[model samples]
Target: MIFKYRKGDELIEQTVVKPYDSVFGGQFDSWNVGKKLSNLTTCSNFFVDIISPSSPDDAPPLATLHFPVYTDQNAHCHVDYLRQFFKIADFCTSGDACKEKIWSTSYPDPKSDIFVGYDEDTQTLI
Candidate 1:
């Protein structure tokens, strides 16, 4: 994916590669060994091109198997939430500076910490 960030008026682009499997039903995608090897070789070559000539250190060894384990549902959920939060943060912080404003008129001050009744069952943030 190409991520574009603005420095003053100029835009800088960065490319990030996310390796994943093609067969998994859930978020943890599986990749074939051959395909993984190919991707690693390509990445190593790219790194070689970018590193300075003085730093002739060879590319770090690549892992043979790529597997991310989410131990529990809560861990998986938190990861998904963080991904969404970053997207929202990017939009909020990009370009011009913006201020936070509360829209609800029902509460005297929506921005202030006012106690609202919570449900014991769900333990939700209200």
Candidate 2:
């Protein structure tokens, strides 16, 4: 998996080969892994890039799962960015939406305090 952070034109990408099981209780799935990455207390511009083995070519990301870690205010800039990238409906959950969807959607763990934005282009959420 590739972990990334972007602001304006500056994009920092990191290739993670080993899993930090001790830090995140060994959760390896995308959602849980994303949750762990989202907990970087000082980070607000975090994103997970799932590299497709079949398509190693550099193309625009078709899907994105945004984890916004704003404690004071539940706001994220990636929503508009993903909207323009995927050309899909914006699905955002915050505060209450976070609490409800986590359980209803069978998320591995609850995400009550974070803001989540899912790409609708891949039709994953539907």
**Relative to the true structure, how large is the alpha-carbon lDDT of every model?**
0.33, 0.47
- Alpha-carbon RMSD, each predicted model: 18.2, 16.3
TM-score on alpha carbons, each prediction: 0.15, 0.29
Q: Give one digit per residue, the lDDT tens place, for model 2 in 13-103.
A: 4444355568657635433435443444343554556554445567655455554444323335445445544664334466656545534
Question: RMSD of model 2, in Å?
Answer: 16.3
What digit string (tens of lDDT, one per residue) describes model 1 on residues 8-106? Answer: 233322333344557753333222334323323111111111222233356422322222322233353455545543454233342233233223233
Top TM-score hit: 2
How far in Å is the alpha carbon of 31 misplaced in model 1? Answer: 14
Candidate 1 versus the native: TM-score?
Answer: 0.15
Considering every candidate listed, which one attains the maximal lDDT?
Answer: 2
Cα shift from native, residue 54, model 1 (Å):
3.4
